[model samples]
Target chain A: MKRVVILDPLWPLEESADVIATLDVTLDKAAEAVGDDVVAVLAAPEQRVPADLLDRAPNVRLVGTCSTGYDNLPVPELQAQGVTCIHVAGYCDDEVAEHTITLASALLRGVHQLDRFTREGGWWPFPREPRRIRGSRLGIVGFGRIGRLVAAQGNVLGMDVVAYDEYVDEATMRDLGVEKVDIDTLFETSDVVTLHAPLLPETRNLVNARRLAQMRDDAYLVNCARGPLVDHAALGDALIHGAIAGAAIDVYPVEPPPADEPAFGWPNLMVQPHSAWYSPAASLAPYTRQIDDLARFLRGETPVGVIPGGS
Target chain B: MRVICTDDTWPIDRAQATLDRVGATVEFAYEVPAGEDIVGLLTYPGCAIDASILERVPNLKVVATCSGGIDHLDVAGLAERGVACCNIRNFCDQEVADHTMALIYACLRGVVMLDGLVRSGSWWPYPQPPRVVRGARLGVVGFGAIGHLLVQNALGAGMEVLVVSQHAGADEIAAAGATKATLDEALSTSDVVSLITSVTDATRGMISTRELALMRSDAYLVNTARAALIDHEALGQALEAGEIAGCALDALPIEPAPPEEPARAWTNTILQPHAAFYSEASEARSFDNPAEDVARALAGEQPLGLLQPVS
Candidate 1:
């Protein structure tokens, strides 16, 4: 019998057994797709499916990642070899947006800082003032699905919501009660600036030293999108010099940031591990959805989440 | 007539302007000056005001506190002595609601824990996996201005909210875009339960050992109200035993949590100084409203924040 390899040890194999049975494939947790009997290989966002996978698992017909980003997958190379490459999209949009809003609120309210202050026996006059969420300006760097959701949430909290996205028109933003602003204006005026843009070569370091300097000294920054979107070093310097009130970042230039993660010592900064896209309800969603897609591909049906270029 | 502002941090200038029109001179003082000329006294949440205060200033006509929570002020005792008591309200409602939502997000997304994990040289697989906020059920334990505003905030963010209130009816809770639930049900089912209710006789230590035992092991508790609303020992035990996933506390049993604060050692808890109800604008309102109320009371006008004795 053919086998499917899931590189994520935490993958809900027992819960996914029904789907595996339907496809008539035995799913096994593996460190690598080295067996010729492996017809399908799947990976979590942090795991990598090397481009040379086909060299070992020659019969592999499907390669899927249980995440929105496929940076770890060689889509073009896999598709050229007649392999169907897929990635789960739109599964964690709400989670990412919620996390972004949470980080923004934490910064504004000084929840993290106040907590530390209290534990340290310093209280009474709050060293850092907690800001009001209502009427505070929330500027979104990307007006994509997740960004739009964040704008809606901020608007509901009575915040002045604005977004900067060249692809998203002003009228569209207005429909969601969001004001469309230029990127420079977003950085200059927003009380809280959050990044929801994808990580691309052109988009990398979008928040450079100049952009950080553009922000109000009392303003805050939140990044739950991608790590490389902002210049990590610049953010550290800005924090050191108190260029901005504070920042909350979930992603980093390096995952599981090295033992000497400089962010730990940075004052007025909140560091979050890259665990935003999770919840018991949505925890198995990506895996189940991907497996269902795999089953569809097995039945000669088009999978819903095939990579654009690969498809 | 003279008005004394007991809190040194209070900007007496804002209140002095209002009193100036009424021919009342207000000044900051360390203690209540013993004199028939003192007509009014302005205090903050930390100062305990009751009938005993009348002994210090026998001719005291009114007392005002620059905070909504009147737990520190004995309204009934002061009212019995023919003294009008006013506590600031609606001034920081939005700030409290926003901060509550922030803590809710922090707990559900495990941002605080995740941040600690990253700093401790760990990363994904998330030591504390974040939960999806949109569909997560939030149990709000009050129906006051802040709780109602929080319901709007949560619903706007697409969270399923369950409100447990003795004051609000099922229809009223439902009208606010939240489901009405019994305390047990809310505790047993919700992903996060927030306490925004005041600490009345029936509410003080409301969340005790039995109550903590009702919560789902994976659930969290957030308190932005008063520390007395929960049993500190019970909460610590619950956290130590993992009876609940975690908790975020804005109010501690002791303000400026002493060097030996037990909660600091509790597992998966986020501690916040009593700084939830704050913002530059809200802070000004907190001081301005109380000052104006005291001025009104001195001017032979009914105070807007008059706390009528609960019959």
Candidate 2:
């Protein structure tokens, strides 16, 4: 009999117990499971599975991460150990895309500022004039599933959508009703620029000082994918110097960014605590799907979400 | 012809230049003051053009408002004085619709609350559960240009839209991919109810205690149109009793809502100053439209947006 150890309680253990029962496997918490009998370990994306921890379960054959982003997983080390790694992707695509639009809409319409103003007993007709999303340009970086959805939402709002992505072909871009443009053109032409690229070595600090300088003076920037994609210091400086109008950042390089982060005090910037991919539905779906994938793996059938070059 | 602009801060340079080209003199003032025989009164939506104000401008042959709503202008009074009243129609439909959707997204997803929580250092997981907007029901009241645009955007976001409007026929609503429902039905079934109706005797105080009671306790109400459409006192009480989940308001019965307003103390309520129709692009149209209307009035031609007085 195969034993499954869940390193982290991704979802309520009781709710997931029914699904795990189908595989005819006994579920045990990480603390109780020991030795070579444990063939699979389920962990959240935030959980760090160091080699020292893996050494305890030498016979473990599968590691399932309940998240789309695998930055937390050390892929090479796991593959070298002859372990199959799986991650649930595309589960929160709609949630993140909707969040991207939410951030963009809030910034464009001045929801945060106006809400505060009214609460503070300020009068109508804000001191600053807000820009409209309709008939404006929305520039999307990394035209993946979330990026494409954001573009579609922008189109429905009557915005002219443009995008910069190396992988998406021109025909696909046209089919999605997004105009393909170079990075610089996107920054310069867009009324709002949103980042959705995966975190990669080549893409780190993609929105640096030079790129921020290229954006329109009244334009807004939204970052929901990852924090390193934007140079936080440069973005702060750009916002302070009025280089750009405002920014809405959902992900930071560091979770729960330091208290003294400069962007925190800036009136024009809205900082969210990397909760863009979280909703009641989104939080549960990834876990449920991962559990099903784990069940399939245990049944000696090919699982659907296996990461490439992982096994 | 001489034109008196009621708003001193209005960017009338373009309009002034246009008037200059048309051989008309223009004067800007914060108020009309008594005994000013202005040939044309150029005003905005918030300015009160009551009978007394018109009496002050005895020679006011034409009253042109730089907004779509003519509720502030005494159309009957203007007509009684043989003065033609003109307003810009559908100028900021896209702007208001965009703002309405922004508020809807903010309330439904709890973006503002999450932002507050994250800013307060509660980072890893959001304390409040966010509602997914996709597959949700959105009830829109008054399917005019702004309402129709909002419906289109909401549908594009994969939401089921229900519309309630006296003027919109069943066929028109169906054609827009929305179901036509009575006000009571829309209130009870929708996850988010948005008010986009113009303020009139028939529509004023439309969403009062009875209508609010029909809404689900977890639903939200978003109002970007006139504030008089809702009974704020009832809304405050309902929010206190947890009758509705929340509200996002762009306008209030009183501009610069008094400090003692009960709704201000409700944490679940989001209050924005009457700024839904404000944008640099929209502002430009507000000024340009009145300028053109004044020019046309001076030339003895019917203005584009002439409003017929209600009998």
- TM-scores of all candidate predictions against the true structure: 0.92, 0.92
Per-residue C-alpha lDDT of model 2 across residues B267-302, encoded as one tens digit per residue: 688888878888877778888988888888877888
Best by TM-score: 2
Model 1, runs deviating above 4 Å: A1-14, A22-41, A48-61, A80-83
Instruction: Kindly report which residue pairs in candidate 2 clash with one another.
Output: none
Lowest-scoring 10 consecutive residues by lDDT in candidate 2 chain B? B30-39
* Model 2 global lDDT (CA atoms, 0 to 1): 0.84
Model 2 error, position A144 (Å) = 2.5
- Model 1 pairs in collision: none
Model 1, native contacts kept: 0.92
| DockQ-based CAPRI category assigned to the predicted complex of candidate 1 | medium
Write one digit per residue (lDDT tens) for candidate 1, span B1-311.
Answer: 99999898898888888889889999988788788888898997767777987777888989999888889888888888889999888888888888999999889888887777778777656789888787789999999999999999889878899999998999999888999999999999998999999889989999999999999999999999999999999999999999999999988887657888899888899988888888888888888888888878888889999999884
